[model samples]
Target: MNYNESLEKLLSLTDSERVSGRGQHTRRYDLTRMRVLLDELGNPHLNTPTVHITGTKGKGSTAALIASVLSSQGYKPGLFTSPHLHTFRERINFDGEPITADEFAALIEDIWPVLTSINHDGSHGFITTFELLTAMAFLHFERKKAGFQIVEVGLGGSLDSTNVVQPQVCVFTSISLDHTAILGDTEEKIARDKSGIIKDGCVVVTSPQQPQVMNVIAQACQDHGTAFVQSSEECTCTLSSADLYGQNFDIVAPWGEFSFRTPLLGAHQLENATTALVTLQVLNELGFTVTSDSFARGFRSVQWPGRLEVLSEDPLLIIDGAHNPHSIGKLKEALHDYFQFRRVVYVLGFSSDKNISAMIQELPYDNAEVVVTRSRHPRSASVETLASEFSRLGVSVKQLDTVNEAVQYAMDLAQPDDLIAVTGSLFVVAEAREFLLNIPPELYPSLDAGMPIR
Candidate 1:
């Protein structure tokens, strides 16, 4: 079968992402099934060293940053992230290129028989969809002889399918309340779950966090006999300048001082950049050769599309995939710091499971014109629901049927100097970005993946 057919086979399984990632029972995340699948695949997870990153936010960017540096330094690092902006291939990349559609089709075909057996036989309690994909990633990395793998946890770290690997370095970006029903409602509990990736002998690096969150991370590292380094404590970043185009900063770490520049906007990215840099230093201590020049080149070259990315300048349109309240707050901060406008129009949509009310409160609304819409994503929150939430905040809200409609309305309403911020879920931002840039949605040659396997 071709790529689309292969994806259909995969999506016709138990997928939590498609169902809003709620109703996640304990049994749904059992790692035994994943372990069994990996063993059947000849334990490909063991073939490569790992850098595992987990957090409510910034994990993807951190993974991208590390992968960029490693690639620039002549290392073949397999990078795995989740909840793609446009396609399933975005979740799996090596040497800065996403796996081609044919490669994906072949991987699925080769593993289908074994994957089916694991799911049907029930000897291992049935592997879930994500577990199967994780297995595929390991197998692909092994096939490629990847020097190291930089993996971002799909959900919480403890029982995430990707947690099967014992990482040499574990990274945590800013932790907050996300995936609350499955992970936890409180920040401390969530921190505990995310900290579960800290295995023995691994070095831990974390962005500056709340005191309580830091406590949980420290205790977890202590329990695992892992070394922990807090990024803000170990390194200081001085932002020389920032604009919608990019930002330039200087970092002072234990090893030395270095200047860095990246097209990734926002203040939170500074934390992510420092966390990545500190982790790379830890990798160097563990005997990976990453020169200062590679660091400079990597920062300049790393591309994390759809995170505070500018798609147009005439109307000052920017899109970010800030789905949760904390991330929305950070998005607000970035807007305030990086751009100026007298009036703003927000093209907003969200997934059904997200805390819409809280996020509405977090999002800035002064002189804000609201256009509510639903993305085509299966879990997209209803336009009516979003409109009501914004109305409750004393904001005048207009309803549009789709992201494309909402973006057009927002553009018509905004002046050249006004900002049109398209955000909420990445799914919505993906649709908006595609429409704005005239790029087709980036599935696997016209395909997609849904469901978790169990």
Candidate 2:
């Protein structure tokens, strides 16, 4: 099968991301299905050592950090994250690059027989598109004989398909209220769901969390009899300086102290970087080699798209995928702290399943104008819905039919010195990023163009 055809067939399966509200997703998140599917494929999830990362906001960034450092040290590391910005291939990265299109299609073809057989038998329930992709990642990593697998959880930790692996280090990065309807309504409940990634033998590392969230994670570690590494308490990270281009920071760990730099913006990245440092330290102690030089280089070069990424300076354009309310607040804080501008124009959109009301409450109503819009995804929140919220807050808001139009409108409304921030969701950011960066669409043949790639 061709790449587009393979993608279409895979996406045609049951997808939880497109399913909104409560109860629906909770019913489908059974890890036994994943285990059974993996068993049929010889349990490739167990072949390589791993670092399994979970939490609401920074899981992807933390995973990218560890994978980059490991790759810098001459290890063939595979990184698996969710919600691709452009192509589905971005979900599975080798070293610093995504798996090639040819590889993806071929892998699907190779596994088609076993997959069809299980589907035909209907023993483990209908496998989801995410389950299939997770299996693909594990199998691909095994075939490549990867030195390590750095896995980011797709959803809540315990029942997430990626939780099958007993990792060398389990990481939780900045647990906050997100996916509230499906995971839980409270931070404590969300933290408990995330802490399920803490397997008995693996060391657990976490960023600084709210007191209640911390208590939940700590209790989970105790239940597993696992060693818990609190990055905030165990490591002191001091930000020396930050600018639009990059930031420099220093981390003092119990093992040693080292300086680091990353082009990624936002003060929150300091926490994610620190969390990665602690996880790498644990990985190193667990018989993996990580030199300070490699760590320094990796931190300097890692790229995680759609998070405080400055695309241009002429209009002072910035794009961030602050999908949830807590993240939107962080994006607002970062803009105020890191950049200087006369006026700001926001091109915003978000997924429908999120806490949209709380997210709207986080908008920067002062010195900002919002151009509300929707992405191609079926779950994209309506511009009317977003505009109503903005209007109620007594903010200047306008509606556009598409992300491209919204970005253009924001740019037109802003002077060259003013900033235009495209955010709210990665699906929105992906569309805007494609237009601004002159990236051609990674199109699938005859597929629902916006089939909720998360």
> Which candidate comes out best when scored by TM-score?
2
TM-score of 2: 0.96
Q: Model 1: residues >4 Å from true position, as ranges?
A: 20-27, 442-454
lDDT of 2 at 397: 82
For residues 340-385, could you state the per-residue lDDT of candidate 1 as single tens digits? 9988899999988889999989977778888999887768889988
Candidate 2: stretches off by over 4 Å: 19-27, 445-454
RMSD of each: 2.8, 2.1
Worst 10 residues of 2 by lDDT: 19-28
What TM-score, over all chains together, does every model reach? 0.95, 0.96
Model 1, position 362, has a per-residue lDDT of 91
How good is model 1 by TM-score?
A: 0.95
